[model samples]
Target chain A: MSATPTPSPAHAPDAAPHADGTSALLHAEGLHKTYGSTPALAGADFSIRAGEVVAVMGPSGSGKSTLLHCLAGIVPPDSGRVLYRGRDLSALSDAQRSALRRGDFGFVFQFGQLVPELTCLENAALPVRLAGAGRKQAEAQARQWLERLEVDDIRHHRPGQVSGGQGQRVAVARALAARPSVVFADEPTGALDSLNGERVMQLLTEAARDSGAAVVLVTHEARVAAYSDREIVVRDGKARDMSAMAGVA
Target chain B: MSISHTLLGLLETGPRHGYDLKRAFDERFGHDRPLHYGQVYSTMSRLLKNGLVEVDGIEAGGGPERKRYAITDAGITDVEEWLATPEKPEPYLQSTLYTKLVLALLTDRDASSLLDTQRSEHLRLMRELTRRKTHGDLADQLICDHALFHLEADLRWLETAAARLDKLAKEVRR
Candidate 1:
């Protein structure tokens, strides 16, 4: 609504440190990953601040998912470093990285990935439960998140019983239930129709902002990426920050 | 948009002075560009001359004389026809972006970067529209959605162009 554009809090890709000198919540530099004989990421660089939604966009197999995997410590890069809150992810033990993921990071995939056997409420509470909270406390927190995401009415149903849109909302509620500092969402709205997709994006973004959690969203759809504060385009295994590019041009 | 037809439609509800018509037009339709008083009066005069509207009353105000106008039966028929007609879809066979891309290749410039810059510009507008839609009412949301979809189409073209830049460069040089 303001005449001036909203200034992005995300750090520029090429900058060694941010202009303001504040460290990013998660940062990766010169990352390279290979699967068999193919290179997924050659030399990608990325950074995100707390509460900033940065969409990772590219054509299929262009390494957007690889960049996200490296950032989240799910897949180690062959040649570069990833820092989470100034702590090197590679330096941590495998157990430590897993622990960090459980306690400090959240994830939402295109398929929702809800447990087919668990009730929606139980599925939403799984992350918090795994993070060492008591079942009652975890379920209570998850219930609140489910309500906020507008899927609480279907809390007693299993994943198979709910609609795709409702299931996706439950997955989002699960991701936020642990109060993670960052949420890694890869095509969270990819499976839904435009109306359902937009609604999911609206709720996901609004809930993430309210929780003050940064989102590294991997999406090829421009409409979905539009929900992000800024975007990084991964081409040929490299990342380019569109906002930073705009600033330079 | 046809300002005269729009003004006539507004008058269909009831007779309104020129100033009141402008305000109503602005509130409902004019968002980015509001109707100027001169444009409103000129449009009203044209509609009156065309038998689409008639002067219902004249009121002498403190500053100037105000004329209240009402829509005629002809105006209602005109609005119906306009509403029923489907707008022609633009083919965009010749695109400015295509021209710029070809020129960049011809001039030995960084065509890929040009596409990147344009893509950024397009996303910037999309982001603005997205934010507006987040806080806007349903009407605002629909309007922004239309603009957002168009910009998204442009961005998709940019992506495809970037992917085929090498092939395009080969053809342009030959």
Candidate 2:
């Protein structure tokens, strides 16, 4: 793997900050991190405007997931900065960041990670309940989201009783129930077949757009990336903006 | 789609008159443009002559007698063979976009604007498709997906072409 550094002048650390007039909801500059001998990110710069859907795509082990984690404040970069709405994320303590994540950032993972023991409605309502909403209110919000995703019939069934696609729909409903400002979905459709994957992607993007939330989606599939407003390709821990070439098709 | 094979396949369900065949075809596949009455009658007559179809019955109608056609063994075999064979993939190497690129270069026109225009058009169509997919039924969703995938490919090509415009211009000039 010949790792020639990519020149990303537009997102350089010293470049004009928020030059796009405060529309940027999330930004990362010169992010570098390493786990022992393996470097996960090497000066990767990224940013997404409000309500935009950006896809982070690369081959396996190319730091796409790491970039997502860093931007979401789940993992701290050893060097460089991450900003959410112009505030540096590195300055926040673990608890504050955790609270921020719980309240403002929604996440959808490849396997859904829904609690098998909990019913679909409960799983969807968990985040809202964690944010201190009453059980009734949380469940009501969850039910509305489930209906939006067209999986309201499975509200009473546990995750174990639902198919993989239905489980992901429930997961998506859970992710968006809080109306998070940003949604980080890491291969949300990876476990499903093509038809099911398309359905999930359509529903996810539409719901996110309707709520005016920015999305940072990580996927290696071109078909999935097509749904996003832009794509950033990570190579050898370096993020390259491919969106400029296509201008969000 | 093969018109004769489609007609035969429809007959496989049950015998139908020319008018009924046209209605069924329009309902299933020809929603955009229904088949002409003359075309349907001509196809049925040709199929009967080729022994792929046999007249099952003739019924008195308002004007002319209506002939109901049924698929024979040969027609059934033809439909099966057609279904089994894969359609040829059209690569479209010399599409209109490519022609326009070269023409712009030869005429010393601004090729970049052409690319930008095409990109916008592709994006517009994609937005339209996304709307349709969101509201469409399962079949409509599938159709929109097919078109969206192809348009995505076209957008990628347009971007790649725009990136190589300078080099292409030089090559074309030489």
Candidate 3:
């Protein structure tokens, strides 16, 4: 799972609208974080609207992953605000944040990360099962997603029994089965071949669109970023909007 | 442009009449604009002459007798070679955009505005393709991705050209 909400101090206020009168389903403002001497994020601002797919791209060690962690509340920022629907994420108790992530957020990573022993169907249903859905209800939802992703025939197979591409599809089915409000994908297709990579990206973005869930995709590949509605590039520990400079030098 | 060779490849699957060939080709690769009947027949005739294809059968029809075509062994070799060969990457050594920028500078025109206009055009197309990708199927999304990549390169070129405009203008006038 990409989401593991970190505990933070409570009683934080709701995040106000951005100075430019902009609002979004998710927002981050002046986020600053450092790890010892090396800084990860240096006053980065980001936002995403409903049903929009945003890509976070950068060179290695440029803090793209950290930005994602901050936005998802997997880690708390040194000094900033992460707001989910105007509610300050920092304001929520640890349990509340964890529950919120479980209920409304989904994640997929570069590695398929399917438990080797669990059948594909069982893996897909894990998120729902964790959320306290009945075993039958969870498996039913998982089966529907698997069929939609065209991997229903392999439902009974263990993760190792499936090919790398098929495993990623299972991961996607799992991430989307819960119908989360947002999906955070970190190089979700990095390990697959080109054909399979394209297929996975297509399914991920299309599924997000169909579910009306916003996506925050972190990837270094321009081809992958091309699928996004907007892109933010992290450079030297700062994140900036690269949508306008997409074709620039 | 490679329609003739593509038809030979298709024929390798099995013998097919011109109508069948056209439909198969359209379904696979010509979703945008299908081959015309005349083009298909003409291509078949040329392939027949070249010995890459042969008449497998003929059926009488209302307008004209339909000759089903089959690929020869030679046709299979040709297709294999074509498939193995890498396509020539279009480096665009002397691109039209480069020519336009130089011409603007040579004629003492506002090269900066030219670059700006081109940049905006590229951005416009990128935005349009982005919208299309959002709503398109897998095939449509792939097609848009291809176009978007080329346009992205053009956009990068436009920016570099804009940055060097002053230096280019000086060199051109000198």
| Model 1, span B1-174: residue lDDT tens | 788878888888999999999999998889789988999888888888999988888877632228888899999999889878997898978999999999999899999999988887888788889999989999899989999989999999999999999999999999
Cα lDDT tens digits, model 2, B75-156, are 9998899999999998788699999999999999989778766665566567667777778788777777888889878877
Error of 2 at A39 (Å): 2.1
Among these predicted structures, which one has the highest TM-score? 1
The regions of model 3 sitting more than 4 angstroms off are A1-23, A243-249, B1-89, B92-174
Candidate 2 per-residue lDDT over residues A32-71, each given as its tens digit: 9999999999977767876788888766888999999999
Which TM-score value belongs to model 2? 0.65
Alpha-carbon lDDT of model 1: 0.86
TM-score of every candidate relative to the true structure: 0.93, 0.65, 0.64
Please provide, for model 3 over B21-95, each residue's C-alpha lDDT reduced to its tens digit, 9 standing for 90 to 100: 999999877856889988898888888899999998888763323888899998899899999999988778978
Error of 2 at B50 (Å): 11
lDDT of 1 by residue, A175-220 (tens): 8888788899999999999999999999888888776788999999
Alpha carbon lDDT at B46, candidate 2: 93
